[model samples]
Target chain A: MKRVAYPQMGNLGISVKSFLWELGAEPIEPSPISKRTMDLGVQNAPEFACLPLKVNLGNHLESIEKGAEYLLMAGGIGPCRFGYYGEVQREILQDLQKDAEMIVIEPNIFSIYWSFNYLHGGFVSPLRLYRILKFAMKKMKAIDDLERITQYLRPRAKKPQQVNLRYQKYLKLLDQAASEDRIKELKAEGIERLQELNNPEVKDVVHVGIVGEIYQVLEPYVSLNIEEKLGEMGVQVHRELFLSHWVMDHILKRVDRSSYINAATPYLGAMIGGHGQETVGQAVLYAREGLDGVIQLAPFTCMPEIVAESILPVVSEREQIPILSLFFDEHSGEAGVQTRIEAFVDLIKRRSERSVLA
Target chain B: MRGYLGIDVGSVSTNIVFTNEQMEVLDSLYIRTQGRPIDAVQRGMAQMYDKDGDLQILGVGTTGSGRHLIGAMVGADCIKNEITAHAVAASHLNPEVRTVLEIGGQDSKIILLRQGIVVDFAMNTVCAAGTGSFLDQQASRLGIPIEKFGELALQSQNPVRIAGRCSVFAESDMIHKQQMGHNTSDIIAGLCAALVRNYLNNVGKGKNIQEPVTFQGGVAANVGIRQAFEDALKVQVIVPEHYNVMGAIGCALLAREEVHNGEKSSKFKGFEMLDMEFQASSFECDGCPNHCEVINFKQNGKLIARWGARCPRWEVG
Candidate 1:
């Protein structure tokens, strides 16, 4: 079996590991992102590359050090810089003299066939491949659902840490579950456990929507655990970007993108690539839903998000919802991010209180 | 003689203010942090105690970058970010204030307010250009007292143009102009103009800078920068009486609100903390691959707080 490795993006690692395992490849899990990873990434990545690419490079380097022979990554075809991450990272690895093969699964009309054939030998039956993919999809959906439940329960829980603990516990159990029925059971059990943590006394929690680039919104390490921080501050976060949502919309072609595109028509008429259009669309949707505020997170120097950030203020004005745009980079300090979030929460809370009294 | 205490421990200065029930400032202190926030807070407290020992502190509030650390140390009733603190202070001082342009030691911000409520705000991210520290460096490099930097700029007959997009380029531009034998005042005036241009383009970008604008923060003390803002906005800028200590005043106002909002008593640890020793230390936790730097804050050789761990393993209240 060939040793395969992939970068981490929140809980997507579990599904990817399972998929690789099903293909009869030994999946090498890169160590969880740390300070050293960031340092290594910053040293090697191009000076102007976005944070996700740098972090991804660090993951590849770490995995290579662990003797992984194959690196699996998704390819893109858009104006956004993400489309070239695979090629650029491959060159960087080759320059470093690392012995590894880059396998980029590009999204195209025949992506399904090409990816399957490349990842699996002809010996594996098509029925088995279908089963493996379906199981992985189920796991992804289950993880996303649990995450959504955790966000809802976090602010309402008497002890937010308990919800986090249970969420982590269930994630581990779901990762270990072999059967689809067990995964479904574990997800249901996790929701029930999380629901029990709600505090009756806690009410009038602030609601904020998170709309941003997919990597920053999904990966806690890259975005600095913003969802958890907001939740701890008694704000219920509504995140629009999820791994399962992206896969369904972009890969499976099951979810429709017209609603978001139409909503973004006023602010962003065309897709500027990446999740920019979706970000603007979701802010509008969240505003219509009467969410008190919305936060847009993006990596510094990201073209798509920069476009979205510029237009979000107009949406915030027209929709009467406050929006804060935070751009992350290698130098982003925890204290600065914390201060901004605290002030934003305070601003929305005060606005809501005043409206209620009036 | 009862009042609230507010402390703003910033990168450059530690400001302390005492406000009466009516939110009027009774006394204030501005001292250099000198790279030691705890010592600065302690010194400020000692000075405040010596002057107003009989006066009772009803509540204590903290703000600025070092707010959390100082809040924990002083047992603050309320701790708020500098943005909220500045906005609250500006609005309270001038209820009709619509915009606030605050340039502090290390960071600068533009806050838009509507009907005394903060509607929008933007802070400088990943860049420290056009801030007070930059102006300070330039002033010293030109061999002029920072206190007289503004006065010198006003004397310029023709201000030279200096690049203001980045501090590195700005410094090189200043040096080139200086070596060319241009008048020092013209160079100083040009530097002020450049800084203001940078501020408006960077920190105040895309925001409405309506009238009734108030400029506060330590940088407001520079008449040159204030003049540059007036020139750029073509409107009079109001500098509040307590401009430098506005952040402290805001949290003091907030602390009063907090105390009045059904809180029985303040959590103030009192001025006696001035005599006690507080130690903060941190170490990398290798329990996981994340290698989170867990910080331990000790007060008088006893552990009071631990944080910075990604997981809740090391966190303590």
Candidate 2:
């Protein structure tokens, strides 16, 4: 039995672990993404690659060191450059002579044949593969649900860290859950615990919508935990990205595309790839909802987000809402970034206070 | 007798400005940071108040990367980013100012204004090629005082081409040009042009820079860069009399505005507080992957403020 490993992005660990278990492979879990991983990634990666690619590369090498042979990766097509990450990373590892096989799951709808073939070598029964996939989908939904609860409770909890602690507790509980009903029960228990954790101190807080590139928006480390920072400042953060929602709409093709496409049409007419259109859509959505402001966080030199940033000012102007665009890189100063965020929060707060009088 | 105090604690310099109710530059001090922001601020304060400390301060404002630290040290009323502070100062100094080109020691910024309100702004990211420190390094390398470097560049009849895309490349190109027997003045002139092109391409990209453009920050001391900007934009770039300390002046104006806007009293920690022990220190929190360097500020033995951490986990009341 070969062991497969993959990088952690939010709740992918639980989802992938279940699928790999059902597929008859011993899934060696990648260690939690941390400072060591980032350092290793930075040392190994090309200087200009987007932050996610570098960190993911670090995850693979660290996994390989821990005796995991084959690596599992997902690909995205078009201008994202994420599609090429798998092959590029493979070449880099090969050049290092690490002797690891990379199994890429094509991001195209229902394009699981290649990965399944690799997993079974045409020996596994179709029924078993179907069951494994179904289990993975259920786990993904469950993991994403837990995350939604965390996001909802984080800012509202008087003790902001209580939400994070409950999140960790639920994550482990869901990971150990045995059956479908058990998983549902654990989710309910998690929700109840989170409610208990929620503090009643939240009041008249500034509501901010965060929208940007998928990786920067979803991964806390990549964007430097911006949502959490805003929450600590007593701001109600309304993040526009959810792993389950993204997987369902993009991978499962279960949702209508027009819902976002129509909203983004006025500002951004074409799909510019790498969540550019989605960013514009979310910004417009939050603006219309009369949220305090919107924050667009993208990696430096991100082509799609640069385009989105260009159009965001118009959305902000039309909606009469403030917008702050923060482009992150490794060298970004923590204090400088904080100053901008504080100033932005103040700008919106002062603007609202003035409007009440007007 | 009554005035507002603004303190700008930057990476390269700490500046203090005092502005009376009439918006006049009462007294200003600019001193090198030498990597100690707290000490630099103290030195600026000492210099500013030396033998002429009779002005009654109404409010205090702080701006720059170290705004929070200095704000807490002095109990400031308003703490603002350099972008807003620069824009505020430029608009007040030149009411018709449409754009601001601020190239500080470690970074640069372009702030756009309309009808005295900041509409758009951009700051340099990880590149110091077009900043004051880089120019200062080049000046030292050519054995010219930074104050005299611009005057020497003015004498260059034919400027040599130097790559200012990156600081390393620019330095190497300068050396290569030097080895090729290019005049030092010509090389310096070329360097100024290179930086201007880089600033326009990177920091000022896609922004509509209209007249009257105000050139400020420590780099404004260099006439070569100012002329280069003027030549490129085909318009006069105005460098005000107090260009270098504009961030401080702007914060002073803002503090004055806050005072007039029905704020109760100034939070200005008296200048005599400079005699007290105020310090700042940083330590990396190994709590998680981010490894944030939390900065702690103290006045005497008691903690005044803490900053630079992403979370409030280490914060103490």
lDDT of 1 at A341: 93
TM-score of chain B of each: 0.97, 0.94
Instruction: Give the C-alpha miss distance for residue B84 in model 1, angstroms.
Output: 0.8
Q: What TM-score against the true fold does each predicted structure earn?
A: 0.98, 0.87
* Weakest ten-residue segment in model 2 chain B by summed lDDT: B255-264
Indicate which candidate wins on TM-score: 1
Q: Model 1, A1-358: lDDT tens per residue?
A: 7888898889999999888888888899988988778898999999899998899999999999998998988789988899899999999999999999998877764766666666665556677878998999999999999999999988998767678878988988988888899998999998898899988889889999999998888888888888888988999999878899888888888898888888899899998898889999999999998899999999999999999988998898899999999999888998999999998998898887788788
lDDT of 2 at B27: 85
Among these predictions, the greatest lDDT belongs to 1
Model 2 misses residue B11 by how many Å? 1.1
Regions more than 4 Å wrong, model 1: B261-263, B286-290, B310-312, B315-317
| Model 2: fnat (fraction of native contacts) | 0.08
